[model samples]
Target chain A: MPLISQQQKAVILMADDDADDRYLVQVAFEENDIQCELLFVEDGSEVFDFLMGQGKHEEKGSKIPNLILLDLNMPKKDGKQVLQEIKALPAYHHIPVVIFTTSKSPEDVRQLYKMGASSFISKPSSFDKLSEVVRNIGTYWVETTMLP
Target chain B: MRKQTLQFLYASLAAAVLLLLSIGVFTFRSLRSLIEQSDAIAHTNKVLFQTEEVISTMKDAEIGQRGFILTHDSSFLKPYVDATQYLGRQLKLVDSLTNFRPQVVQRQRVRRLFYFAQQRDAHIKQLLAASLEPNRPDYDLRLIALLNRGKATMDSARIVVDSLQQTEKLLLEERIHHKDQLSANTLGLFTLISLLAVLMFSLAFYLLIQEIRRRQNYERQLEKTVSDLLRTNQDLEQFTYVVSHHLQEPLRKLQTFSTRLVQKHAIELGDNARFLMERMGSTANQMQTLMADLLVYTGLGLHGDTTDFEVQDLAVVFQKTVENHEKQLSAAKAMVQFDKQSWPVLGEMEQLELLFSHLLQNSLKFVVENQRPHISVHTFVITGEQMPFATQSQHDERFVKIVFTDNGIGIDMQYQDKVFGLFQRLHTADNYPGTGVGLAVCKRIVKRHNGYIHLAATEVGAAFHIYLPLAN
Candidate 1:
């Protein structure tokens, strides 16, 4: 498992418009006891800025994320557009994108899957369910799955 | 614009009637003229017949005189005696007939012919009387000369009769030609009028068809507008669901924070603070449940995904609903009994399960003191007329009426209709912990199945009569 490797650390990037959601995801990730570096962005455009190591993220120790949790509803650019761009680009195409949104619409689920989304999850109403979903995602992507 | 079209149609009809009337009048005039010409031709024929009869009667008189002159048989003079009277009457008839303005020349010839006929008659009578005498000077020469004179007079009468007959024949031919021309013109006019009437009627029919087509187009446009409004309404409902979800976000945060505040800081927060936090959490939970129930009420069948509906047994659905309230039923030790008669109902199973669950929960919630909840499911077959809200669904006219009776506080007859409305409850939240959307949801589900649900008045407990259409 990637987490069992002592020398290496997995990086996870989450993009959401709501600050409380971003903070709650961090707490939920920590509550599962899964050791991973979690990064947060306010919107979909900041996701690109962080990935490109530009603007405020232009530091020497900046790292590219191994997994991206994308929110569908955001200002300037939506998660769908960002997902399309990340999938289209050569450098970030291999990184798995998980759609985390409040929409439980079947059409959104089907469409996100069709647009090369790795997984789709409707935001749970309770913190317990949120923690449980976050644990599953972290365990599967960071610990269980093999990466290049 | 329609009025203009109708006015034009009326005008065209009036023109058609006027044209037909004119054609009729013209035909009548032509027919009348043709009849007059026919009468003129008959008059000419009568004149010609009379003239020839006058000549024939003269020849008959001359034969009688010759027979008497040769044999001196007085009985042969009977024909000559008869001719004198008959010929006089025939001449008078001819004179009166040809006295009209059109037959003036024929009338003059008839007068001349009458004079010649009288002269021949006197000579024949003189010869016959002379022959009867005993002796006379130059008797043979006189008889021969008198006979020659009678022959001459008959030739003159024949010539006048021939001329008069020839003029009458010409008049008959002219009258016949005029009548033929008149009928030909009438026939041409009749054909033209018939063609015009056909054209006028075709134009009116075309106008009517155009008006009908325009109305059909308008109806289609109205239908399109109504469907557009329905689609807009669907979008608004979806938007409402999303907005309500967003609104519940803060309530969720409050609930979580209040719970965490009590769980982690019970020692730092006094009993009063903890109790307040607990109350806040409970309030948030109630609000969340209300929001969720509201969402469910707004979102029923919004996607129109009823393709999973099938013929399901109503007893099984009721059983599943009972299972949903298994914990409550076990605690209450409720007695739930279904009739042995099979209930084959058609619907989406999950919705039916929800519907029955709401009814059972309502019965459980509304209870008399110390009364064990006893529910009995009864079934019967009924026709459409027996059901008040019967609709012409894509099913048969026969329906299966399911009666669900429970031993609980029965609803008042007046409040029976009111209970089905959204957010309408008889008891306060303290008495019955609910959002008051259960019966409304049941009504919606029943309506989706093309059925009806109504509260029936029962002397004992509450009875809900559900009428579901049968499918053959």
Candidate 2:
């Protein structure tokens, strides 16, 4: 129940199909001075492989993520399906999932929340604002609250 | 028109048909009775003619008897014998004709007349036999007595025949009068039935034509409505596409590049250059928020799924709204109190949640600078009479009234009407941070649920009253 502490490195897994989005998010976190081990996947399928230690991620072993950031638009599999599959499994349900996408639709936000997303953050267009959003997330999720 | 109206028309048509059938039956019965009365009259007249024939035959027989009594000759006796033969055949014809008369008294009179004729014939024969007797010394007296008896019998027969004729004549007159009256009655009934049938037919035809016109008008109106809806849908789709793609995509690149310029080149650039980049980034960010809010506003204009509606608990919706604004509520030290046992309303849950969230956010955003906001939510059932605006035909429906009263800077009465207008804002961005579409979105959401939302006059902070139909 304690905060994630500066000594313990928190592993954050992010799944996005867009290379630009993945790079911008990494830069945003760096701008915010967030100290965490960030992992990346190109699509929803890779997210699953990373979580279950399957396919190319099998040699990496099962390293449970403290939080997962998912994008709604992806190839092969979408974020909604991955979120549903992750929530349906009792073994992976404890990992906090945050929906990070460009869509600010109320329906998408409501549906993601109903599907057990811990938070819904609209992907900011500006890196400065994205840095602020990332700083806030790190402060709230990593520095302020306990992660399972 | 409607199914019930059509059914009523069919029922009326059936009733009219039944009425016409009954009238036909009645008219036929009346005509038959009239014909029967005419037949009776004709029978009475025939009986009258047969009685006259019998009376005339008796007169001939009396004449022949007198002639034979006076002459005492065979030639005169020949006339008497022919009279007797003709009398038997005439009497038989009279008897058959009289049988057709309706009255028993006429039949009896005919029988008495036949008896008188037979008596007369017997007296004639007696008179002739006496005259033929040559040795009889009292022949003259017997002949004279027989002649007197024959005359008395013929007179009696004439009186009976006269009475029978008089009765037949009276019956004939009575029957004629009855037949005439029946004919007049039947004519009158036929006229009335024809008038009634014509009136019913006219009414039915008029109703059918009116119904057809009404249905045609309804179809035209429906077609117009459908076309208007299609056009509006096309406009909304275009708007959505532009907002999502063309509008946001460029703005996203603008903000991204502005932020990158400020982040990577801030050391090489002067203070003013860095400020411009920062301002560019902030402005792009503001525009993005505006576009997002606009998307939501326009999205509401899109036709919603009608099947998404269900009976939803207002308390649950309120809970979700509170949870969504938890951070803001805690930061402002705001308190939102409401009855836990709120009434259930018929609506889409997500839309209702958004509606409540906007209202709650309004209260949170428009508070006094140093004061903690206190928002009290009250719910109760209300009739149409309690509504501030005019209600048409929904007066009988029960509405769940939800009132959100806050202890913040209240809106002026003049601006209350404009608060729900799209993109209408009373405060500057520096004073209050909002896209000025929160209340408008709430209004759209409420309207989607067939409900109403309005700003009630308040002395302290803002008060919003939302009226939603209670689930029956």
Candidate 3:
């Protein structure tokens, strides 16, 4: 019942195919002075590897991320596929998944929400805007919404 | 051209049908009259033959009487008896045949002839009895007197019969002449009818060929237009997708890098480099905004998925859109008043929302300085015929016209034509901050909904009339 504090580290997993987008998001969090531990994955496959401890991830029973930030477009598997896999599996179904993508199309937003996305955020262009979005997402999901 | 051809075709068809129908009725009447005339001619022939029969029977009776008087034979007397028996029946036959009102003179002659024949028959009988008593001295005298009387009677009867035959012959000639006249008139009418028919048929055939040719040309033209529209739609979809996806990626990076450069190294950058970076960042942001607006404008018409359409209440759509703009509206102190809120229309709900959203934003952006913006939207139900501009000729079709009036800076009359154009900006970016694609998007949205958005003439503030199909 206790709210996530600044001192306590909350791990947030982020996935995007674009390296610059991933780096900018990391820089946005850093510039905004948010203390949440931000983790980055390059593509969809890397997201699964970090989550399921499969393929090159030989370790089992890894620490589950408090939240997942997904991108729509990626190599090997897409955000749609990962969202479906995470929602379908009972073990990871409790984790809140937010879709962060450059596609702000109504169809995509509507479809991702239907597929049980916790939130849908269109990636902003400027760093200042990205920092603003990053700070809000941290305040709402990490500080306000109770984790399962 | 097609309409004219169709009208001509229908006209020619009607003329042909009328001519044929008239010819049918006329021909039926003429044939009936001809049949009646032929029957009359047959009746006249029967009357003539019956009169000749009566005269022949009388002659036979007289001939038998003379034979018996000369030879004094009983066998010759047998012919006289047979003739007398047949004579009365033959007279009755002639009388019945000439009984019509038109044969009054013939009937009189027939009666006189029957009387004379009866007198001759009585004289013949007297001669027969005289021949039986050859020894009596006065017998010869009686016989001579009787023969002379019978001769006179037979002559009178022959004259009457001749006169009757002559009258009947005249009547027959008149009937034949009348029949000839009828035949001649009928032939002329038939000739005229046939000529008219041929002329009408040729006219109809010409119109038919013209109609077929016109329809073929129209079909070819319609097919071409449809394919051209399809090709244009495909190209537009491809362009919108490419600009929204591939084009925005680099611009996003450009803006992010400039912002990150400023955020990380704010102290070390020179003034000119910082200014260049700021312009570069702002320009990239503008490019992103332009691309995004262009995508929306281009994408509105690309939703050919007609199944997405549903009965949308414009009032509800407007209310939801205004709620979405609540922060901006309150911040700008904008007032939106509605005279009607239950305006129902058939459209895609999201697109309708988008349409009103752009218009609401337009009213908010174009507000005059130091004035609170007041926007009022009213709706009216109107028939297609009552549409201010031309549309489909479904005169009974109904539309919901949403009139949006705003107490904002209205467009100049001279720039009205350019207001809704894509990428058209009436004011500089410094004065009015907009991409100028908002109105274009609104127009395209209206078109997608089988509706229209037109700028109405207003004296005080901008007035927009948005027409949509009224959902039942």
Candidate 4:
């Protein structure tokens, strides 16, 4: 095992539209004792603004979210459109996207995987299930998987 | 197929008739010719036998005359007398038999010779009765004179007879020639008719067989068309499955991400963040619902194992749907009304349950906050040409009506069309926690049941009117 760095700890970013779900994810991370910061966005449009360092997210030393946790359905720009734009753009093309949704549809599962999503997770119905999901996601992205 | 067979049968019958008719005509002609030839041959043989009989009777007369001269017996004279009568009768018969002018001339000559022979016999009698006197002496001279005249008469009669026979032979030759010509002409006509009949029969048979083959080809084409249509249906089914499976994959990701965020960062996030998170959750839920609806929509025309689906009581399906939505009804404090009477309907149990559940769930969801919801479910049969296909769908009559009424926040008329669209929501995310695909799914199921649903006028709430096709 190698020593973890502060800059590497800030490498991963999450973009999601739901506030309670974001809070639950943070709680799961705290419960698992994983020291990684996750970012959030209201929808796909805001995520783009945050990535390009424009709009309300434009500020000095505001770092870009390293990874995105996209919600497929949203008002201004859904997860699917955001995933397409991010993958299309040269600047943000290297950023990994992991879809997090509450759907059990097989189509959504296969499609997100096709669109280069690193992983897809169903919204856990219970807090315990949510904790386990977050722990596994953390282990895969942080320890088991390689970074860009 | 039966019609073609009948045509073929008729053709075969006509052909057989023609063939038989041709054979009959040929046989008739041949038999007629044979009969004519046999008649000619028999006439010639009879003439020869009649001539021979006349000659034999003359010979017998000559023999009797000779015997009377030699023995002077009365028995010989009797034979001569019978011979004379027979000869006279034979002469008359021969005259009737012969039409030639020369034969008539010969008959006159024969009559003269008979008279000469009688005169000679009288002279002989006078000579025999004369005494040995010089006065009676010269009977030989008279007898010589009579004999010479008789000989002359006989020679003339023979010459006439020979000329008459020659005339008869020429007449027979002309008859035979005409008969041959007639027979040849009749045989030629018979052969031509037979050939023509055979040609007509063969042509008709060939045409009939060709028609049958053409009809068979048409039947085969019809069978192929049906098979092609079935193949196209299978392809459409495959396309639906592929589209449903592929389009749903991305929607699942949207739902997952929304839940992940709410689970992780709600406590640390601001009010704006919380609002965004809630909106995200709403959107994710909507996508999930839309995907599910799409699945059902694509799978709508698929027919499962069909069994005896008799008309079932609507109350059963209605009660089941209500029970499924018990929790929601309890939460909203909704008072649902139903007609407990068994209203029979022809429907699939699972599909009918889904349809009713979706409608009732909508009624329960749209209740005014903190207000008791009032819902009613009822069904009625209609008759006398007032049917749904006539009045609602196709403007015909005879129908069954199912009325579902609810005392809830009524939808605006402008949003009616939008309400039936997949994921079309009329209210804000915070007020209503639904994907808005319920009404669309209900409409689909209703349409499958050969029914139509429309918004009925509501005084204080929302009312839905459904019309179903009635079975006889």
Candidate 2: pairs in clash: none
In model 1, state the lDDT of residue B440. Answer: 95
Off by over 4 Å in 3: A1-13, A23-42, A49-67, A128-148, B1-48, B59-235, B238-242, B262-269, B299-357, B377-387, B390-403, B445-451, B467-472
Ranking by TM-score: 3, 1, 2, 4
lDDT of each: 0.83, 0.83, 0.84, 0.69
Best by DockQ: 3
TM-score to true structure, per model: 0.67, 0.59, 0.70, 0.48
Model 4: what TM-score? Answer: 0.48
Pairs clashing in candidate 1?
none
Ranking by lDDT: 3, 2, 1, 4
- lDDT per residue for candidate 2 within B1-472, as digits (tens), equals 3777777778767767877997989988997898899888888887788778777767776676667666765576565567678878888987888776567887888789878987877777777678778578887787778778877887898889889888888888999999999999989888888778777777777778979999899999999999999898778766784556447755786687777887788889889999888777778778887887888777776646756689999888898889999999999899889886668888877788889888888888888889999999989998877776637777888898888899899899888779998789999998788789999999989888888888889889999888998888
- Please state the error at residue B281 of candidate 4 in Å: 6.0
lDDT of 1 by residue, A1-148 (tens): 4644756677789999888788778888877877788888888888988988877788834567888999998898999999999989999889889999876656678888898999999777566667789999877988898644
Give the lowest summed-lDDT range of ten residues in model 3 chain B: B387-396
Q: In model 3, what is the error at residue A137, expressed in angstroms? A: 7.1
Q: Against the true structure, what is model 2's DockQ?
A: 0.42
Report fnat, model 2: 0.68
Candidate 3 CAPRI grade: medium
Per-residue lDDT of model 4, residues B12-131, tens digit only: 658768777868977787777768876875665555556556656765665676576556566876766787778777766665555343555646644553454454445434433332
CA deviation > 4 Å runs, candidate 1 = A1-16, A28-36, A41-148, B1-40, B46-137, B144-214, B257-283, B305-316, B340-346, B391-396
